[model samples]
Target chain A: MAESRHLGDIILKIDHISLSFGGIKALVDISFQVRRGEFLAIIGPNGAGKSSMLNVINGVYHPQTGTVTYKGETRHHMPPHRAAELGIGRTFQNIALFKGMTVLDNIKTGRSLKIKPNFLMNAIWFGPARREELEHRRKVEEIIDFLRLEDIRRTPVGMLPYGLQKRVELGRALAAEPDLLLLDEPMAGMNIEEKQAMCRFALDVNDEFGTTVVLIEHDMGVVMDISDRVVVLDYGRKIADGTPDEVRQNPEVIKAYLGVGH
Target chain B: MIYRETGQYKSNYGADEQIFPIRQDRIGVMIILALAYLVVPFIGNDYWFSAILIPFLVLSLAAIGLNLLTGYAGQLSLGSAGFMAVGAFAAYNFMLRIEGMPFLLGFILAGLSAAAVGIVFGLPSLRVKGFYLAAATLASQFFIEWVLTKFPWFTNYSASGVITAQKMVLFGYAFDTPVSRYVLTLVIVTLLALVAKNLVRTRTGRDWMAIRDMDVAAEVIGIPMLKTKLLAFAISSFYLGVAGALWAYCYLGTVEPQAFELTRSFQLLFIIIIGGMGTIVGAFFGAAFIVFFPIFLNLFTSTVFAGQLDPGMLSHLEQFVFGSLIIFFLIVEPLGLARLWQLGKQKLRLWPFPH
Candidate 1:
């Protein structure tokens, strides 16, 4: 497991990040770094602070204690919108698609960040607004094609199957064209085939765009198969962080996974 | 075959993004507009034009405004009547205070005034949501109505708390004639509806919908919730305000503070709920239901049981029918007439082919 020593190149540095809800500590002094163009999996038992870590990274929960440095900039109390504006995109553990909107429209919503046409132009239906809308639509269609959602492009996301809905969520996150993508349990409820398709899409996204991915996954097989590194958490602390092989062999991770005293 | 889009090629983005991409819809809209402008005035009598058409058009405009806020933006507001009162009172003050003020200018100023009031009232939405926010809007409704009734200055120190509108002229022609008033209202309603339709298709409209759907997710996605929600309030109030001015100046010609009351807000809310909440066309549908149904009911009651049924009985019957209809529509199709229209289209698309 010596190859575990080189866990890609570090891209996101989380330093002493801690979060608490009144008396309960969700995450306590947890720190981790994700490498550029790397797939980092965060896995833990329920209430083990895995999701809290993702929330801190995406600015959903502001960490009370340390700084999150992304691309060498120290992020302090930055809001989710600011994080999104700085090329950070994320999907929720629960599906967060605009339910009433069509797949195309939902994906198009992700491109809202890229659209800079002024209100006057949009109000008047002028040249620049029309051009920008068309351009953005073209890009969205490309995403639709990439995600193989062409048939259901005009169908409402609410009516789609859960698996396709998850894919659409991924398409939506990808629509933002973020440098760092966060997926909160992308394959939580999926069957094996759906999981495979989602993993392939994740790999393609990483390989094609060279984007950094931080995923919270419970499926160890999927995590070990795709993740360049895996960070194991237990009781609001980072119990282990290394290559999948090293984390798999770590005695503490085994005890946490098995629920037995070492 | 009647509603087909075959052979209709959109070569560019402009063509594709046109408000009505289907040529038939555009052509149908043009024909309807022409009919509204040219034909309605010629056929309608004075009572129809003055008592029915003008009021219907004005109320329809107000309903459209409320629908934009309550339906599209997902912000339930009970202050529509108050906003309308603001428009009416503001327009009155503007007209009476300023010498040689144009009739159009009074309406414009009134709309702006309503927008200001609406923004102030909408502040509570940032801290509250759903039923709580709705209850807060009720405060706007009560407060504005109280001001309109209490302040003698609003009614120009009149003891009766009523104001009569002066004769209105746009350019050279007076809107004194019923035909001219009807035509003017038709034109204004058409223009405003077009503007509203276009508004919902843009960034601001999308922002409103985003906030409506899920404010938390919208904020995370970089939509400024406060700004977007406030813009919805302002625009919606502006439309309601203008409609209010038109209601007073053109339709009533004499107005009292009691004219825009809590009952008026309920009427508008019912119109939207019965019409279809989020769809633009639902405003007109709801308005027509609220306005014409009552008239039709009265006429039918008087005609069918002339001198047989008591007046109170007839009123009771009307109320029962109205309440039942609202409940029936809500239960059967909560999406309103818009869903029915979509269903009809879908049926037509699959015509001659059985499942």
Candidate 2:
């Protein structure tokens, strides 16, 4: 499953990315590469532009200066849906499960980019639409099985505890069957046990689906444990990028981030 | 014991995704259908059909349409009755101007015309949200009524501004009697409601609910908000439009712009709020509550007062009671009567084992 070794080409490359809001810069000359089939963690203090970087990668924000190259091809002004259809899936910094929907329905919506059910067929729900629905439902159910969400498949996500809500958000991202999964603060606000579960699932997703994961997290335990490499951000600039041990020992990183025990 | 489905299990996704997944629910629906189709036409009196059942069925359909947009999609729409007016007039115009145009085609075309108008009004939703979108839709309600009234040709220039719908013929049979009209209304509502039920459980329905929950997240996840929101508006309007046509042609047998006034719009809004937002069955419960509450109040006040109280005072009392009840339901069970129905079903599922 390539768990021990990340021996693949660079899959996503961001070059000289610079973004500013009015007079303030959110990201300045932040450059990094995400290797194929690897877990990459971005860690920083508050206002570190970690989320903004992920947003840029997903086409939610167009950086003032940058070229996002994926799979050796430079990106264009593709809409978010087109980017999602191109196999880029992400969960929100805060849990974004549809409040009124059941866990199963929320995950099924993750398959929206891939489904081909036309308006009329969806309205009637017979023949091809039914077949497509079953096919997608089967996929979603398998994800439900994978994430251990079988018990609460029919429960509205808003009613669930915070930990379960984050799990459902992860399940939705996984439902897209994406090549690159971006998780923003997936383990935030979770207890140790829930944090452990989320890390295990993140690793399992990389191992089983061979999905390359890029995550923004404040939990150094998780970032250092599962991440193959770490990128540290402070004040919209990348201070250090290396293996966890290397970044942990770097003098500048220690002074800037680890000095405050972040 | 009849409520239980302990031994039976769904074998596949298709079977599992069945609208009434529980075997007991399937049977319950069948029993209700059997009663509606066979019993009502024969046993129900004319007063029951004309005064109670026809309006109930039509308004229920209208409620479902509004629920689709407002409840399921989280798009506030106050122009539902206006869309209904569009449908009624569109059908009337189609019937009047065309030679030998079938009533069925007229109905479909009317719904389509409403859908068109609905999309036009829904365009503002791309730029606005929440209460602003609602205000835009509210404008449609007044705008449509104004156009229908000012242009007397919509009513065929009748002095009284009423255009009586000719015999509602289906397969050459005239649906003129109260019983026949009730049957037609019932059949149409049932079929549309069934289609809506099927819709909400599927991908398209999920998209609408997705936008309703969080539009930004929905867009980031690849749901095209513009497409989804407008489609919600279009489909919701189509349902309301069809209901409007039924109200005029089947219930009133006439087209009058006043029939679908702004008050009618508010009535539809109240239907979804009290019925349970985002539920197909909630539409019926809400409509029933809205339609029957006034009648119940009138009867109760009349019997209690025994004609001693002034009718105006009694009417005011009825309004106060109705307003208070709406507030009570909203505060207590904000999900509405549909939520209550669900709770009842859940309780029934575990009956004989109290805990």
Candidate 3:
């Protein structure tokens, strides 16, 4: 697994993108390139527009300027579902699992694009629809097993602990079989043990699936430990971008973290 | 004890994903189907057929329709009766205009017509939600009623705008008697209900539910909001249309625009609320409650009072009691009757064990 973990050509290129809400700028001319099969971390203080950057990547937000090139196709604006169809899947900062549904069903929902729907076939639950449902169920069960959520397979996601819910959200994104996985503070509110488990899962996802991962985190230790590259954002602009060691040595990033007046 | 699934094991995902995955549930459903098809026809009388069963089944279908939209898809609609009226009138026109058109074919056509209207009305849901969306749908109810009443063509130039439904003829067989009508309703309702059950478990159903639970997350996750919302409206109206056709042909034998009024839409809404939103069985439970509760109240009141209370006052008393009970049930179980049923089954499965 370690030998196979090699970064290839650039998969996602964010051009000089600028985004604003009325008068408040969320992102200002922020640019970055994510190589194929690499774990990239975006770190920032509160309101640093980390989540907004993820949103832009997944097409939840359209920047006023610049294009997102994914798998060689560049687009100024893409719908969220179209982005998902193009193999970009994301989890929210807040746990966004379908609360009413069981864990199994929630994961299965990630496979929405995979299932070619036939209304009549689905209504009857026969032939191709039935077979497809079984097939997807198998895949979802595998995800459940992979995430060690077998005990809670039938449990409603709302009933789970915050850490477990975040894990399940990751499981849901993984179920989508995405080429690019975007995680927004997945370890937020988790204990040290849960954080370690989450980090392990993230590493496994990158190593085994060879999927490109973009993570937003505030934990400096976790970021320095896991990420191949780190992009530090302060006040809607990229301050530093390099390997974790190089980013740590950069005075600009230290000033952003340690504060200007202090 | 009877609901136990201790020994039953699903070897595959296919077995596990069944609508009734538990053996006991499968058996229970089979028994219910057997009773409905084999036993009910022989035992039920004309009053039972017309007054209770037929309306209950039809309304259950309509409730299921509304449940799919409001309950599953989270789109509040106030135009269910209007869609039903479309079905009733469309069926009427199909039978009248076409030479020798089959009743089943006419019903399907009526459903399609209602579906079209439902789509048009459902457009507003894309922009608004909650009370605003409900208000938007109310326009469909008033507008549909106005169109049906304003035009003499819908009523075939009838002065009162009341359209007597054409004879329900199949492939050379007429469903004339109460038992026959009841059977027809039971079959259609059961089929549609099963179809509904299947739908709610499939990907389509999950997408609707995802939208309902959280639209922003749902959209971000790639569930197309426009297509999903519109499909919910169209399918919901299709079911409502069929139910309306059944109401005209089998239950009432005649329907005017007044019959499918705003009050009727409220009744349908009440059924889903009382029965349990988002559950197919909840629709049936709600329909049964709505249909039988009043009659039960009347029976209890009349027998207990024995003409001591005036009929007019007694009816008012019944309404008071009914309203209170509805509020009580809602307060007791906001998830509705289906949840109660689920809890009961859960308790039964763990009988005599504290854990």
Candidate 4:
């Protein structure tokens, strides 16, 4: 296969996005641009609207204030399915693998957006549908190989250990073949070894696929290491947005991480 | 060792995706089916055919329907009996209203009618889940039974709200005899169950399981929740509807509205729970347990404990034992007897090695 081209030329621009839950504001006038193929990290403390930002990008929770423009197209309150169709894939902050399903099946669920054949063809188990299924299965097998989950691919996700389950979740999201991937706390519950393995996989995904990634993480070290740019969120507002070195030295981000100066 | 899969390797997708991936399982199923079709007809007695086999087969089909909704889809329903009632009544109506309608067609049409009603009740599932959704299905149970009983039209204005079956002939073969009725029910149930098994392997089935696991994630992944869930209800009700027709036409030879009450739904639910939720074979296990346990208890009470206990006490004891068994099964192994069987097989596969 030809080397995939860099996605950095594309831009995901969030323009003055504001989302409110009932009467309270969850995100207020937040705006940021994520260049394609860039590993962007959103860092914030508890209740800093980090998850809400990811949710807005994936069309989970639509913003009330401003439109989101992706690839120069203005998108206002599109459904999650449309977002998925538009090449946006995301993993939940809390692991959300289909527990009763095998790791393979859960990954196959990610391919749902791409499959076009109707139920009749599927029910009869022949023709175009069966061929499509086999094609997808090959792709899923490749993913399983990439993730080194060959042994556990047939095991139900619920039975897997938490760290492996997290990997399976990533595998599922990757199955969508999205242009932009949103990962919410990929290293949340992992130990040092698992975290390193995850960081390596995440980097490989970006390098190999040239896919743009936006991650929400609390680990500043991991963020500084992998992220091309870091966005700091505080109280539903953008506090700082710059290169890792620039954001680390910024007084506002320092104060947000550690309490204000004595 | 006959069940071992050693030396069998799947080299392609077709081999890997076969319904019975293990060659032994495939052979075993074929052998059992051969026995059922070829041998059982000649050797099986009349009493076994009429009292045990026929009712068991019908109830098993009903259990399979309930399992699809409650077990696989995680949609708790208390309206199995109501859907079955719709099938029986609809079949009856089709027979009475349409001139020269075949019995088989009437049963199929009855199932379709029940599916229509099941979809209507399934609408509430979109807004609710768990116990609340279960309560909503109760509305279906009550409403269907009430309508069937109160409305004179359903029973053809029969004096007692009872619908009796006329002699049902399929291609001039009368299903009046126990053997013929058993064969008909067996054929229909086996075919439908096979369809149900295949249905669960399709995208629709996966979509339902995804919804059961997490609706939000399923929807986010682009599964149309409404379509998948409603299809489950429709298909499940269709099965129950067919089973209902069989119960009335083949088993009872007549049916009343009271035949499909809330208690019947509860019985079906219990069967799925104790048999193993989500496994097709579990439906049969559950049905057999539910259908035979009472009869076994009655016989044991009348014969073995005849001198030791009074008849009234034995009846009460039977109820207590049944209730206790359900509670015991739920508490000890919520996965039910199916899991136990699986565990036994696993141990056999790995004999002499500690798991």
Estimate, for each residue in B1-355, the C-alpha lDDT of model 2 and write its tens digit.
4687788887888778898888889988999999999998999999989999999999999999999999999999889989999999999899889988999889999999999999999999999899998999999999999998898988889998888886678688988899999998898999999899988988889999999998877987899988998999999999998998999888988768888988999999999999999999999999999989889888899899967888889888889999999999899899899999999888887897977
- How much TM-score does chain B earn in each model? 0.97, 0.96, 0.99, 0.96
Clashing residue pairs found in predicted model 1: none
- Model 2: reference contacts kept, as a fraction: 0.79
B210-323, model 1: which lDDT tens digit per residue? 778767667767777788899889999999999999999889989998899989999999889888888888899889888898899888888998899899998999889888
Candidate 3 vs candidate 4: the DockQ winner is 3
Provide chain B's TM-score, model 1.
0.97
Q: Estimated TM-score per prediction?
A: 0.96, 0.97, 0.99, 0.95
Error of 2 at A224 (Å): 1.9
Error of 3 at B143 (Å): 0.4
Q: What tens digits encode model 4's per-residue C-alpha lDDT throughout B1-355? A: 5556779988998788767888878998899889878888889988988889899999999999999898889899999999999999999999999998999999999999999999999999999999999999999999999999999999999999899986798787788788888888889988888877766776667777888998888877878878889988998999999999998998998899999999999989988989999888899988888889888888877898887987789999999988898888789888998888777777766666555
All candidates: TM-score of chain A:
0.95, 0.95, 0.97, 0.96
Tens-place lDDT digits, model 4, residues A51-82: 99988987889899898888788888768877
Proportion of native contacts kept per candidate: 0.37, 0.79, 0.68, 0.50
Clashing pairs in 2: none
Instruction: List candidate 4 segments past 4 Å from native.
Output: A1-7, B352-355
Model 2's i-RMS, to one decimal, reads 1.0
Q: Where does model 1 sit among the CAPRI classes?
A: medium
Q: Which structure is stronger by DockQ: 1 or 2?
A: 2
